[model samples]
Target: MMSRRQIALAAFISPLLLSTSASFGADIYPSRPIKIIVPIAAGGANDATARALALDLQKKLGVPVIIDNRPGGNFVIGTGAAASAPPDGYTLGWALSAALSLNPLLYDSLPYKPNDVEYIAAISKSYQVIAVPGNAKANTLKEWIAEVKKSDGPAAIGVSSFGGTVHLMAEDLGDRAGFRVEPVVFRGEAPASVDLAAGQLPAMSGILANLLEYHRVGRVKILAISSESRLPLIPDVPTFIELGYPISAVYWNGVFAPKGTPKSIVARLSEAIREIVETPEFRARLAAIPDVNYINGSSDVMKALVKADQDYYGRIITKRKISLKN
Candidate 1:
């Protein structure tokens, strides 16, 4: 029903409008608030990291940032929520080593697959540690292993969660150290740490950041840490490499978005986080914690790192024949 002149104008403007729409969509990503999903309960390391990142991101990106804790199903609950979110710039997820690298290999089924999410940037890397009660008779890793040998049964080694990074680290370190450790799974690190500190549990293994406070308070004794080099925060503590075990394995935390999100959006998000991580304030905060390893890069680099890490963990799981039953 349009006249000739009106029809001509509409057709010309439609192409220009389409081009502008695409440009605006990509350029002004995250125009509103962004949500970051943490697949662990609040108060845990993962949750804390997410909150810290959210604070900085909100300030730099000039938009409100919100954190949603979805802790359950061994991290599957919150992770699944992230995987299923719309592939826009709005919903971001925290990818832990457990949910991203270990889950697909350790479990028979999962609510989401590795392909469901895309990596944005690396937040922090941490190594695991083996600790015992402060009052334990054995003071060193060697003495502890010798004492376990003299015992009738294997002493339980508490891991924060089943099939988590620490669970695998404990088992793997035990193998390398020529000892038998029966892993005891806990719902989270705080409870296991508390019980270990109170002497209810004999031994516990977890990321150094989680146990360093307990060590500082004399609630627990950190005998050995699993890292290639000694952490600067605890120069007195020896690493697995230093103890002749060469059992250094680390856990990484990164940011993620649902798959199929625009590369422009992902790149913007990655740059924002990378800037935050490089700031002196960020490094200072990490230094306050124990043995935090910082890794930063572009979105493409992070993606490549994820693929390589996935394969590495997958190989380890296969070689160890690690199953959920263990």
Candidate 2:
């Protein structure tokens, strides 16, 4: 028995109420500044990439992004911290290939499972290189291998951590080339690089981008890069494939939120990360870095990449019995 005006008013307010509720729900996301936990120590490749992406994301999302360094346990410490955080958009972690893909195989017990986080986007992919001190007599990988074989004792290879990607790479090199690699562990790559430059360690394996400054300054000499093709910046430096030892793996940097975060918030974060990676300036900067490639993909693609890498490395670790327990 209500009047036509009343019926029309009710109809109008119904949609308005629904719209307001949706807006309120969306507004609940990112209520404050976001925290990005970096598993590695400050000044390493992961930290540097995370800080760079955080800068771009802050500009795009209009929210402050803080980096929390939790360096320990081969990424278990910080990744565990991130996994245990509230399933809100405020807490995230910089997911790297070593942690998300290789750690499960390397360690028997992990605090968190790979499925414990929602993948966002990959920031970049880096190719690794083998480097020696600038004054080293060996000018090429062949010469370096010959020199190592000639040494009376095992040739020392510096790595940031045991069971890391670099360790596996060095192991693979030794196995294929029939040389003995004595791993010299350090807290992180910066120290390893410093020791290598000082001639305390004969050589080290690291991301090309991290070693570029030293290479430019003639502090370290890159013997070979582990990539499918030569990097444009250093075309003179031959790839492992060219030297008759083709072993290539891609190390990527990504972002993730704790599991059970809202789909809407995940979408928002994924979109923001995509925007940051797609920016021309970011693309150019990544390209300029030696042997680095920018990868921009959806959340699903990132998840698939993680899964693929996990399976790939799991097989290698199992077959080789590469356990961190030792």
Candidate 3:
């Protein structure tokens, strides 16, 4: 019963209507809950940061943001899960520089590839610190280096993992200061702190946030930090650079989604995360943990950061002949 002109107009408008509907559909992202996979246990600065972000993100996105902790294998298990997830923007990964940069350099094979995930945004960077037992004789970096140099054999220093940021810094310290360094690997920083507090371990290298409490309570003494300049959290501690050492090792945390995720979703999440990171509330939260302030970098900035860490650490690894292989 329709005229030819009417049929033609209907055909023309139907496609445009469908296209507009699809565009609207694409815009309705995160209608359901989103899960962020954290590659560590449910404690410490990394977990706390992820949980805080999820809380704020839930309020911002109008949907639940859940954290899935998959801690083990130096972040391989969780990172692999995130990398293999569907590119629908529902699953994301909370990662550190170790998983993205150092793992590739240290290992011959990895469960996840660098290209497996797309960088979303950087959250924060934590500087490493060298701490000794609370009752250790050496109270300063100058004295500590002399003490280690005089030790009979390689001094044992606790580390979270071989080739980790702290491990590399410890190795560099030994190489420059004329002492044989032997690393005692632990599952994480907590156990290392335990050993350090009990006087079982001579010294350990860990993030400032984790060691701040121990240092405050007189359980351990932080000799030197790895930041370029001194941090306000512990003003008395001098940086390795200030202590006449060229060691500056800091690790960062960021968010990422599996590759092939829609740019729209990436942009949306990046904007939300970056906004949350810049707020005073969030800044205060991180400051409480005493982490080096929030880093405001989206995808491109994250990419550059990863690459810079890779390049710098790669040189150190190659120069020192560091290897995780047994």
User: Whole-model Cα lDDT per candidate?
Assistant: 0.82, 0.82, 0.88
Clashes of 1: 0
Report clashes for each candidate as comma-separated counts: 0, 0, 0
Ranking by lDDT: 3, 2, 1
| Residue pairs clashing, model 2 | none
Give TM per candidate: 0.90, 0.86, 0.91
Please provide, for model 1 over 123-156, each residue's C-alpha lDDT reduced to its tens digit, 9 standing for 90 to 100: 8888889999999998888899888878888668
What is candidate 1's CA lDDT for residue 305?
A: 59
Scanning candidate 2 in windows of ten residues, the lowest lDDT window is 283-292
Ranking by TM-score: 3, 1, 2
The positional error of residue 311 in candidate 2, measured at the CA in angstroms, is 4.1
188 Cα displacement, candidate 2 (Å): 1.1
Query: By TM-score, is 2 or 3 better?
Result: 3
